[model samples]
Target chain A: MRKFLGLVGAVALLAACETAPTDGANANASGDAAAQKLGPAAGSAQDFVVNVGDRVFFGFDQYNISADARSTLEKQAMWLKKFPGVTIVLEGHADERGTREYNLALGERRANAAKEYLVSLGVDAMRIKTISYGKERPVALGHNEAAWTQNRRAVTVVTVGAGS
Target chain B: MKFCVRFLTLAVLLFSSQAWAELRVDITQGRVEPMPLAVVEFTGDNSDAAQIGAQIAQVVSADLERSGLFRPIDPKAFIQKELSMTTLPRFGDWRILNAQALVQGHAVPQANGELAIQFRLWDVNAETQMVGLAYNTVADNWRRVAHIIADTIYQRITGESGYFDTRIVYVAESGPANKRVKRLAIMDQDGAKHRFLTDGLDLVLTPRFSPTLQEITYLSYYKNTPRVYLFNIDSGRQSILGDFPGMTFAPRFSFDGTKVVMSMARDGNSDIYTMDLATRQTRRVTRHSSIDTSPSYSPDGKSIAFNSDRGGSQQIYVMDSTGKNVRRISFGKGRYATPVWSPRGDLIAFTKMTGGKFYIGVMRTDGSGERLLADGYLVESPTWAPNGRVLMFYRETLRGEKKTTKLYSVDLTGYNEREVITPLEGSDPAWSPLIP
Candidate 1:
């Protein structure tokens, strides 16, 4: 009975480890307050994510800003205005469906699409930087379209603000 | 390509071997039956030498068998047990076993600590020596000698250069799907003598070997900045290839090894560029808004083949080395990426996606003679062996919730697909030119 329980515990631990976006040290340290399940502090990185949503999705092979993404960018633009001293980095990612080199270019286009939208919405372009992870870093773990739709997104990471 | 010219040369032995003028093997086209040949264990003077000789024969047999052109006959069927190396084999014995050819050799220990090895290839039915040679090497490097002998046999039979004596550089991957740790790794073409070229602190991908030097050009994400870097295998030194304002990736060497062509993405756009290694001067190859990457130079260095989406879909395009004479070469129903020109300049291997299936295929220079060599759920990055007879690529499949990525190789005939065994998951394999 003890051996059976131990095996079950080990499998559960493996499942938990495989499903999350465990991008090494920084990722583990980023979500302490959220893990505690408390209401996020105002203007915190968690607050920005919980209130205004930091990610915007793109269509397959299309880098043009969509109407839905524009809505999210509008909210992000207002948040940036509230925290004028905040600096953000736009991280572009692609689905694993494409080649490595092409996905990198497409990812850059996705991030720049969000960056250009933020610039047009009255945020300072200098305060925002863009980097493309291609398909190397994904937030999701599946190989289906559900995961791909989430993978093909540009995430706004708060570089300097409440987290610091 | 010059240092080992003497020991490497297989003395053709023209006048004595070619008494019969009939062609034995033709692997250029069509389906080929693996020529049945008897590869006997080499005889040696001492026990240590005998063990080494048997190991050499095993390697030689495995190398020839892996090529899919020759079938090493099972040694258990040998009718005659003991035989002297100098005396020719009884032709009737080999003929009884239906072996078209016979191979025998002897290993002797030299006084100065080198090993002297002599091998002969006999056309059993022709009743004559097809080819024979003796070479010397340090005892530890007997595996290399075996590979060289395999190449000699392959060339003598098939009339094409063998890819046995080569190395492959690839990306070694671990961790999980979201945050993978990738390091640069290299090994023998048959997956022996493996070594890691970089620590896994940073991400690296797509390493390519220089055509004429022991250097590698690849993409590295050092200090969290993704760019192309060159590494010298002998010195263990690495440096960024060029100073570009934007992100640089997808680097490959020109045929002459004088220039490196790569893609630089700036402000949401990527284009092809070439940089001279000696002068550090840069030349832009493509000035387009669309993504143009994965640039490969032709063997003659007159043309450049690259992947671009300029025609509204991902396709392969060829232009003059100066970026003129633009032409689309893929008119098929799928999108193509990573167009690598064969070292022989006859075909271009590429990754194609259609109907949600990824295929590694090869096409003629003009985009005709399209042949899909291998297909899977997701396959990308097709690189050719130095001889241009086989291709190595990575294949990924989803098993339950886990993703399995592995390296695979297949010859041009669409048969003989093999999984190249590596310690860890490997991708983006680049086959080096034959080590001289």
Candidate 2:
């Protein structure tokens, strides 16, 4: 009789362990799904946030496509493909070293350069729109080279749309 | 003994030569304070006529004083008893009253049923007649005669063109912040005779008059899209400059008023483009990865001064008309924007932001000698008066629970700061040429 009680106790313990193990695995999977939803993943990629501290440089007031800018756009394009439904607005900015009107024009060219590269990588051109704030808005207000590099950037802002 | 004699002779020769030459009193360091003069009642043929003459003289006095460069003295303090322009005044009387200059004038009715106005400016210290001018106009144009007389005297004393007979074209605002309405308004420099060119059907910003004072080009948001529109001052007709598929803002007429320079945005980028008003041909001046706007032409129309962020932050830059040979001019401690070339071509005025504060400043074209003239919560859009002696800009104040913006003017010397009176909140002031 004691031997029989031991077997029943072992069965009850195994049943409780099985329930707890399945619950933990479910929690882990959901956390990963949330992360994948927030960030770029495989299969669907187009709109990706540039990591903090990364920079996109221009060639002396020229906003034409450059090799380095292409490499950066390549990475962004991969992430954008992972999230196919995302639409983006490319914001072009200029540093505080030129006239207001010319800076505005330069900013437009910069944003367009990024947009063209993305479209070449199979991102829909219709998914992107550009806006030049001229010198009206500045992310870094310092009067130094470091601040200017940050201010002169083309940012891809993601939004939810019907593409996916 | 022989050397000493030669030295003494040379010294005497030098002193006499300096004295015989024009005694130029390097007047650069004078008190920029306005000169004080007295305009008394003109003693005429009849008492009733004298009252009318006095009224005309008073108007002239007010015109000069309001310029912020002159101070009209009280007639009651006049030391001279003779107020007639035909008679020679007692110059010693004006000197005793601390008047550096005195104006005496008389008005008489002519046989042709017109008014003949005669005026004279007297130098109190030199005890001599400085200038005398005469004008014949109908009785209703007495105010204009006063202005002309003021201009003549102002030119003689200050040795500069007078700005009393000028006007200003500015954007007038009404209603609340989100759904505000703006109209292009023109008024005398003293803020009189305010007239609205547009019936508030659309929004307007930055209205600048042509060099001929006959046309204006400004940015308007008429069809839910912002574009530069040109309007004839006399005909009251309007037209758009180009059919850009995107936004266009910050428009200015070229120095010759033949071309319009503005910023056009397409595909999420804005670039500086110019269009010939007569030909309607468009050309892209800048192709850059940065935002460039607020372009101004040099007085000679050879170069343009604009604001950009290509260097990572906003700064002032100058370039040739074809967008070549570009050079950055501003290297100050703050972010500089809205660079405007002075009409005199000596300085460029701009708005600077630093340390959470904004300042109106002027710098030489080469980006040297940056001087901040004024500070406020927010200051932008520095426009030069036609003479380049004064700047008119707008300032915003951050106080209480609401924000307020108003127009203000300051001389290039950083003195004579005064608030430009407007009926409502206003910004983006552009001074116009003197009316012909």
Candidate 3:
């Protein structure tokens, strides 16, 4: 009878531990889950989705892929390989400090750089189309360093077949 | 004798009343809207004459309406008694339709088989002959006659020269990013008759016309080296203006077409420099560490207005042709660039940036009465039409993920904003003087 009572007490202790009153920890876990939901799907087999804040730095006015950009692109390529049906549009952008025509050319180079990197990583070149918005479209409207960093980027937007 | 005296007294009283009692309405502002005008079909002596007359009239109507300052009212709405241009206009009929102005013309095939078009403008409110113009051109030159008629009407009403006979030279862009193909493009001011001057082998920008309207000077990135080049518009022949080693940009011809002023960069700094076209001699106009570009000569060619960042930020400055008497002109609450001195020499126009907003503004030479004429997400490169009464600039609008840039123009009065139609995206418009 004492052993049976001790077993019941042990089970009760396990239940207490499982449903402990760690409210802050539970809230944090839920918050992380929400963020995961909001973020682009990872480990997808189809196409890779680049978030807006993802940085794609360039060497001056160049659009050539740097080593740092390659690693990020490799991760993107892995996701794209998983999703065979997904397609992406690589959008190139430029900072506001240059002439309009030159910046347009620079933006195109940046987008093409990202696209070429993705292709080199085994993603289908045909799956990626590139366009340059030049300095006309700025993600950040400020004229400071933060805005320039944001503006000088290329975003990979994922799309399904025939639709967005 | 007593009856005559009484009649004279009455006539004197009537004349006095008419002189003093004329309706004095102060037109401080008219509808910034285009003046609605009616152009009836021109009557001709023969069927072919009538056809040519109608074509000329249509051209005139199109020219006026395209200017954005005049809205050629639809002739379909006309209740005029006669559609034929040969008939005298019934003033009462035009007045009933509320047309502020009426244009009527006649085309006749001369004995030499050429066309002679005569037109007249009637101020409906004034009920008098505003002006009469005549044009003689070959059968193929009917369009020219039409344009001339439009110019007459425009000049009579606006008290300014018409830009109908002008052309714009701009850089045409195509191809994907990184490998852009640029060509020199010229088109009518209304954005028609587009022709690419270059074969897209080099990159070109900031094309300007000489006062004679025959020569163009612009910067070309040929063989990866940027230099100023001059091209004869009529012959399509081009040559490098000066043998400069570094980058040369923002080029403009002098008023007499005898010199070229541009910004040349060596090392990392840029300064304004001028080259005598005949002698190929170069002279530095400004010796500053800051960026000094977009140099424009005054109408008299004695002074220049340009933008420089020597004052910690970009502002406009004026200096003599010899690079003396340098003074700051713009003191507004913004960074100003691209200062273009008007052909009229009354005001200096510029592109201003403040609080992340771009503006096209104009100020007197003394930098007073500064007025922000237009605001946009991005508006740059303000070029004056030949008349100095209108300004053409480019605007860009941002969509969700796409951005589009187009050309637009506005009158100096802060009225008449209109889009110039182009087949592709266009910017950096430079208006040429009227072709002599």
The 10 consecutive residues of candidate 2 chain B with the worst lDDT sum are B1-10
| Candidate 2 chain A weakest lDDT stretch, 10 residues | A45-54
**Colliding pairs, model 1:** none
Please list the Cα RMSD from the true structure of every candidate, rounded to 1 decimal place. 6.5, 15.7, 16.3
Q: Which stretches of candidate 3 lie over 4 Å from their true place?
A: A1-94, A97-164, B1-33, B81-87
Best-to-worst lDDT order? 1, 3, 2
lDDT of 2 at B142: 61
Q: Candidate 1 residues B118-139, lDDT tens each?
A: 7888888888887778788888
For lDDT, the strongest prediction is 1
Using TM-score as the measure, the top candidate is 1
lDDT of each: 0.87, 0.70, 0.71
Clash pairs detected, candidate 3: A45-A82, A45-A83, A46-A82, A46-A83, A108-B177, B43-B85
Kindly indicate the candidate among 1 and 2 with the higher DockQ.
1
Stretches > 4 Å off in candidate 1: A1-38, A161-164, B1-15, B19-23
Provide chain B TM-scores across all predictions.
0.96, 0.88, 0.89
Candidate 1 CAPRI category: medium
Q: lDDT tens string, model 3, B291-404?
A: 678899998999988877678767889999999999999998977878888988998888888887789989998889898888787788888988787899888666753446
Clashes per candidate (backbone, < 3 Å): 0, 53, 6
Per-residue lDDT tens digits for candidate 1, residues A95-143, read 9999999998899889988999999999999998888899999877888
